[model samples]
Target: MPDHPVPDPGRSLEGPLAPVTEEITAFDLPVTGTLPAELHGRYLRNGPNPLGLDDPVQHWFVGPGMVHGVRLRDGRAEWYRNRWVRSRQVAEALGERWAGGPVHAGMDFAANTHVIAHGGRTLATVEAGALPYELTDELETVGPCDFGGTLPGGYAAHTKLDRQTGDLHAVAYFWGWDHLQHVVVGPDGRVSSTTDVPVADGPMVHDFALTERYVVLLDLPVTFSMAAATAGSSLPYGWNPAHPARVGLLPREGTAREVRWSEVDPCWVFHTLNAYDDGDRVVVDLCRYGGSYDLSALSGQGPLTLDRWTVDPAAGRVGRQCLDDRPQELPRTDDRVVSRPHRYGYSVVTGEAGPATVRVDGSFADDAFTDALLKQDLATGRVEVHRFGRDAVVGEAVFAPSAPDAAEDDGYVLAFVHDPDRGATDLVVLAAQDFPGGPVARVHLPARVPLGFHGSWVPDR
Candidate 1:
């Protein structure tokens, strides 16, 4: 993870992205190997543990298609709440014998089988529903917005709650144009009324953000060409930071039309994968500039220039906090990572990087966190880097509550680490305070996870 000048940015790729040589870094993150081995054959206690994870599914993290309830006590680990019997017979009985349990053939892009489990007990979940917007006004107020329209798919959301109180907050990204939509839910489930946020219109939308009391929206540039879909990415594109970013709002009892907007172009990348508030001010791990290095563009060169930023919403300031020398990977995978597919040692020398051979110049940040794991201290410009050795990489990561009060370094760090050596992926956990000290445990998964989007930490509620 040293320094290298980004691929010389020049020319156009309006037609096709040129194929080039790859040069990515590999990772050897904290490891715990196989699930059963690490579980010490204790696959008995199933379900997520608030204190951390346990057998069957070690570590308290869930990816798409999974949602849970959590409970956190100051200085203690989290625990899954409301869970019951982990019975396969129960699940099958629920569907076949009874009528409540749902059965689906498989999974994909559709929001078909969203599961909400409380301590292994079935709760409210959606397999085929739009974003969860309880119309009772129990959550944040919602209405059509004028900024990015419903056409761009409006926004994508992930929700979390305050354990003691059922106070809920959802952070999402506007798909029409990159904007942050923050929604808060009270005890009665009443949500804050909201209005459309304004920003430079673009081709696609990414993720949104939320702190305790704020909603941050980011507006960036994206491109559209059928070609992008074929490669699993959209590049040769650019970004647009409209002078000032805005967040629209309305109180619970008020009309959605009465929403008030706040201007806050977060500090860095308009589309951040994940972040939380730093006190009153909103802190975002930002991503800047993005384009393409079609070998066709440079005749024979490859893609490289990818940078990251840290934005302070209160002051509307942007900081170029870290520069992941690998520009190729940033625009696609950001700072939030768990793991990637494993690639054997010898295959690497043969120019075969397994699945990641998708591109050349190794994995670098084009417009996101790149392949490097970066965490920034906004108050002091301090940055920490967890290099994923070689083609080995973690996808998105979720934080374990360090304390009931939410101490910055009090919780644990849980992620899915991609082990190319074994051609598989594993769920890994690490004490946040003991970060680089290594893993507390690793649970080998029964299957391989392709590059994933967002994830959550559902501790004991």
Candidate 2:
């Protein structure tokens, strides 16, 4: 299952993955330092914009889910919106209308990637099976949310929020499903629990690892590609070295015959920087992609380190450990230590990579961006970098917790930076124990927040 070739769909969407065409909203924006009057609310990001910025895009995660908010309160940086998750083909490609709800397996498209906020709503997720699009805390588009209907299936884009029983844990998958479900949404948003599990080459479970007893499941080696979805490929998943690189665990109330698989060694995890339950062993930590899409181009794959995985279900074994070999990816920790034990982790800094860069107008761009912003320290391995140089492009950094029992590196880290010499975009922040210092605030965003994928500092609870 390794040589399926066929990936070249053309790539370039102009500049930092360009795609902004309107939908502005601005307000009291401009700020530079000091903004933490207990740092109030909305940082909400979610990407894959693409409402046809000159067409040609078979996969940059299949565009069409934009959402870039920024609100704050006491110490104000107040408003700065940018919606477009209308879905139903972005509301029929903007002629308007659809924004309506309930479209489970029939998948109403665009929910971009991540923009969480459990029970009290505010979601916009996306993954193999799509079905979450409820925004509206100023981001509009309140539509597809199967939870009230109890969500029987389809929904995922990384949803693990169990700050101790507020449950939310997702793991859905569906290239037509040969199994892999594990939902759990309770906390009043519904879908109490689910379990499926099966498997055998439908893999692409993008992200998973939530430990307060286990839900880990990352079957690895990419998988799912009906020949790149019959070659139209809007992200048809790839790299299937015969699909057998396991790690299942399951049992946070168990089922699927109680899960527990364990085999590891073929890597590919999109994100996860936290997981815990030591004792009977569970550990996790992530962002290790020794391979991906194989040229089915997600920046054409590989180069991302910082691993760790213990799993040891008594003796079933799964021990990986490579804590930091540089090259990084979008990890983040401290959503109140999601799924438990965490000692700080945050990433962004995909430097030293190569692949998707053929722009002499022949298109194909995505030279990784992200010039620095890490903060590891997973119990004393200490890493704190914060470079933002090479003209700045950084993306996912979210941490924001100076209270509600603060003390885990105690405070802010936010991030949206993209200051290619002030062409725009700021929102910086960073002061979690002042690691690489400078920038206790920055806000200044009137536009250009392009480079994305995963965000939340939602607060205002």
Candidate 3:
């Protein structure tokens, strides 16, 4: 089967998308419109930021992780800060020894893909590697966390929280391991349980899904390849037709040995919007790609379409359908509605073009370079798009509830928009109820925040 070509690592580091060289902070950012008085939190985003300009990492995902954050309080944009996660590799690159602690043998640490706040601690995480690194509310590195040395192994970049139980769930896959571990971290920040699920090949499980009764895992065709590693490619995983494509549904309180695996057509899903228990079946909404990903190519594939998969555990079957044909990714719904039927979902509308040139990745490059924001009403089958026109690009729009008890969809959408024309970036806030009415406010940044993977809104307590 034909696969997409590899992306040029050097070219990925050029232009406005290039990683920042150093960390900096700015105070009292300018705003164009009135800030939301109810919005009191920090908008923090994480991405790969190499330690040196000449560092040669073949894939964009492997660079050192850095975080950019903007603090908001009482309708004021107080300050902005960017800092490296200070992983062992990053510390070594900076002529400093790893001061965090002794990492587990065979664990690689980057912690660059995502940043989240849980159990009164902020963490920077990367999948399939070392333990999560703790960060202060100010985004300073507190050190690596092993949940007081109780965490069994590496943590995943995408971990889901149970609103009712305050428990965190994750499925973790190591680089060469044939088995994946289902880990549960309790509300008090300790590993509650872990179950090892065996598989034929080590597939890259970027993200998983959570329902009220089940934990959904994707075992796709992308598998670890010895040939790719021997060839010195930075990303050693590639498409393998021999690998079976399936989804596993494990009961929330059950072990992996009790998992029911259902077969689905060969495809790849990097992110899951939401999943819910539909009586006897489980319904999952995600951004799905038809086949395997080409780690070498800049864009990867043509486009990822929003898809819905209905998994019937009793029949061991997965029924799939495309919800929308437009190229989009980074699907997010209101956190309060997670693991339940949700009415609204939002994603960045990615296009074929990059900031100033065509992206080498066969698909659109990053959410940060997307042309618009899309809001989908699952009940009405209606799609509303907020286009930024030609030169402006937007990142993931995280939904911020107006209050602790705000109604679903009664909130604001926050994202960072980079305008190439101005050579600057802005924190854009949109009223969720009013779809395409333009930004309610724009907080200007002194420098451009490069396109990145994931971010979150940490409300001030």
Candidate 4:
């Protein structure tokens, strides 16, 4: 570790993206507007909060994991809490022992990308082959979970839960491995199956899409680089033009050899909106970057837009057409309709128009902050935008249905929005059908929540 453990003065560390210092707990939060009487459960989001950076240069994506959770029940905001996932280094930094069990591939870093509840447990997850850390309902770190010792390898930051089968599916890639591993955890909280799909370069697979008959893999251009690793970069991956960009459709119940590879243009995808089987073809909607991981700039270059890829196995090609050219990321749809045809989708419009640049003192420019949320009606090609005022930052918007049999748009969209005016964060709830009509309720918090990755609305069953 470095002597001071301070972040290098070349990354974004100010404003809403700034990291918080300590854990906090607040209760009986004040709320504005009417709270839904039927809404019950916790809204949790995970993101990087660097305890200390030992590396010479730190990427914004590689910080230690911290989870912020707000509990709502019976039309009232009950509590809000934040806790760091207790990896060995994080525990030691806090003067506590590591709470997790044995790790795979010697990678026990913080699981700081997203959090979800499945099979009666809460798990904080990350990417690039880190095991998931289990947390209690109240946000206490329980330790790393390998599914009762049944998990064969590392876990992924993004896992898709099949509403029809009650199974969770993930695709994981390790730097040392030559192939990507597809893992399935059954509804019973155990690993049911594993399959290895070989590839050329060790591409950075941030997220994958799951459909009814296939697990979609994005083998893009960004890949592992030894030079970046030796250059003291915490995230040792960069854009590789030589590595061909392609998408793979692996049979849901078949081996790697059954995967049909379809060629697409060179691009990078960090998240997928959703995927579904359209006849014999597969349709996937995702946020696509023109390129990613500019090693010199240490940021992504080019505009990001929502694009749809139609994989035609009969033609051995993947066709892409831009649905919306607006710059955005972190797309989400109704989780229940994941891997199936549906209508409504939502995303946060990142204001960054080009490659993001950081200041010499590690501060980001004003354009780096996300300022609005948008709702897209795929059925009618309608889009609604909700601006959270200037300098306000918004995280991912997760949809929770009003009922088990609720209509596709009959739900609430929940997100954490930082209000520069109040200098605090709020859990803003908007009616899915009436989006852009202002939040129905804003549960104010005691502190600010930095802009983060994906999260889930864990409804009480």
Candidate 5:
């Protein structure tokens, strides 16, 4: 490990972006505009929230996980709640033991990064930690889930749900394990299969893609390093040029041995919007980075642009093209169109140097931050943007379907925006179809919600 000085925790865990100190529940949140009566659900987001004030390791992604959520019902802002995922590391740090019961061997739960509701349960998940922790609609931790002791490894933070099949698919990798496993959770919330895909090193597989017939696996060059791990580095993964950059097309119902690998230029993808099958090729849209791993600068030193990759299975090749050149991340689309072709997508526009900016090139300019939300019409190549100006920063925008059978883009784009001037956060709701217009409603919160990763909307049943 290269010799380096101690990092300042204030950079990642202080001020308007600071982590909440404790768990709290607030009732009847204040709203600025009228919330849609059809918008009834919880907008829950999860991210790293360090418990220790003087934490020795201060990497942005190294802290314990905390979730901030808001409840909406009958056009009224119901309540707000924030809670830690209660992993073993979090339990010990808080001087508490795991009251839930004995944990499974080799399970390390952080339950951060992303949260999703499926099969009648909400799972709080991280990429390489313990199994997902079950949470109630109110944000209470029920306990860890191993699919009833069937999951062989940790669950990936981003799992693709098949709308056609009602199945949950994930590509998971462990820190010390040489092979990654492709896990399938059935509609009944049980682990159906665990197929081990052998590889020489443990690469960080943050997210994957799914089409009508296959699961797309990204085996990039960011590999785990034992030197950095033992040297007290907060993030131990580094770029290995020797490792081949490739995309694996695995049959949805087959084992790992049936996967077909195709070579592509070296890159990293932290998240994907949507993917679909097109005759003999599979097209996937995602935010692509050029370099290896850097925890201090999660986006790395490359241009973080929205790109589309076309994978030709027979040719054993992958082609890429930039959809929009503006710097952006956290691309999302309507979940109802996931695993198939969709016409609309949404992303957060990152600016030069601001509070919520994930500097892709490791250089932070004075005024750089994510300043706007972007809406793209994939069918017509039309782009619309919603800017927040200079004093505010925006998080990922999740689309909530307007009705059970509404059109693909007929819904609201919900996100948390932190205003440094006001020193508070607001849940901004924008009409998905009216991207040129401003927010339909701004649900004000009692506290400032620190910038975090992915989130999901669970509509009231």
Candidate 6:
């Protein structure tokens, strides 16, 4: 796994190989055959951007919201952290939260710096770095203990920080979803190194997990993105993410051994399940299968139910042994959604659906969409979908770490919401005791965030 230098976009697209706009439509969004923009103002928007939750955070998972790198007094904003804003120098790069994006695209707006917390206290707020987030808790941008490698940048496709080893892990890819880039960051912000691995055939590595010993990934291979940029094409095609999907397991150390990839179709590669280690075996709940479908045809379609798969970390053995023949489905409105592995075996995601069909072009072709507070039982493979009845679109959700002596009633989930239809997006809170139902609260966001890629609760550990 060698790094294939990402060629300059202008140099790659010229002559006949240039990407045609028509061809790019396929690579922009996944899950085709829905509907078109005819539903704009009615469902989408045609006005002069009436909603002013401007430059809000896009796709993400949640950590408690903090102010000035400190936990804030208000609940309206939990830090929904991800790679929406990075230091990439590419122009065509599309920002938003898709696993892959336009050559040079992004926003300078940041809601709250993505921070790691201990209960209600702030430990670190790392800006997007090539390796894990920078340890901006109390240091300069450079020098010792700094993540200095250059990541894909532009709202990086995906990232994961291993809880076991405290090694920050991020995923980077050039194109064709065939290659894998793993960046590890130490607690001091010092980067280990970057390594290339095999990925399923798609444009993005939809989701990934980092453990004390291994790095697991679900690669949605649409690898031609780099080739398209090099050729100066807006839309890069001629790639197949489904020839056979793969789940990979790699050693966490350097040039790890037993790196393996297997064919498996995960439904929501981006908005997916989490991986947990049970000692004797490692368990991962995979939301199988995704694509870059046309939005014009696939509007009005609901969310696709996802199958849960459990994998063996040592042997790379995979099986859909947990879910039913049909998986549980979350609401498919336009709100962003995210999930984290639960303590026992179940997983919880805070999300909501909207009436709008305008989703950001995430890292993969169909990388971006919306969701609700979804409660899933991995063992029996049952799902509970929580819809936004009050017209609220739940954004990122995380199971706040529970203290050893913490009361059960004190246990809760933290989240954010983006509701453009009502012209509002807010930070929110839900009690896990009553999750998928029960009591909920909303905090008005200081601004609107579209959607983001990967994030974590970083419980008060």
Index of the highest-TM-score prediction: 4
Query: What's the TM-score of each model vs. the native?
Result: 0.47, 0.33, 0.92, 0.94, 0.92, 0.56
Question: In model 3, how large is the Cα lDDT of residue 132?
Answer: 78
Residue 76 C-alpha lDDT in model 5: 85
The local distance difference test score of model 4 is 0.84
- Model 6 alpha-carbon miss at residue 61, Å: 16
**Candidate 5 vs candidate 6, TM-score winner:** 5
lDDT of each: 0.32, 0.79, 0.80, 0.84, 0.79, 0.37
lDDT of 5 at 221: 89
Which of the two candidates, 3 or 4, achieves a greater TM-score against the reference?
4
Ordered from best to worst lDDT, the candidate numbers read 4, 3, 5, 2, 6, 1
List where candidate 4 sits over 4 angstroms from the true fold: 1-12, 53-57, 255-257, 291-298, 352-362
* lDDT at 76, model 6: 18
Candidate 2 Cα outliers beyond 4 Å, as residue runs: 1-21, 28-37, 40-42, 54-60, 64-67, 73-77, 83-205, 208-217, 221-226, 238-242, 248-261, 264-273, 283-310, 317-333, 336-453, 458-461
RMSD of 5: 5.0
**Which residue runs of candidate 3 sit more than 4 Å off their true CA positions?**
1-12, 95-97, 255-257, 298-303, 352-368
Instruction: Please say which candidate is ahead in TM-score: 3 or 6.
Output: 3
Best lDDT among the predictions, by candidate number: 4
Instruction: Please state the error at residue 439 of candidate 5 in Å.
Output: 1.0
lDDT of 2 by residue, 188-269 (tens): 8899878888898788887898887788888888888788789766667778777778888888863334787978777677
Model 4 Cα lDDT, one tens digit per residue, 68-133: 999999899999998888899888877788875969899998899999988888999998888999
lDDT of 6 by residue, 219-276 (tens): 5433344455577542343345354556666776554366766556533344345555
TM-score, structure 5 vs. true? 0.92
Shift of residue 421 alpha carbon in model 3, Å = 3.2
lDDT of 5: 0.79
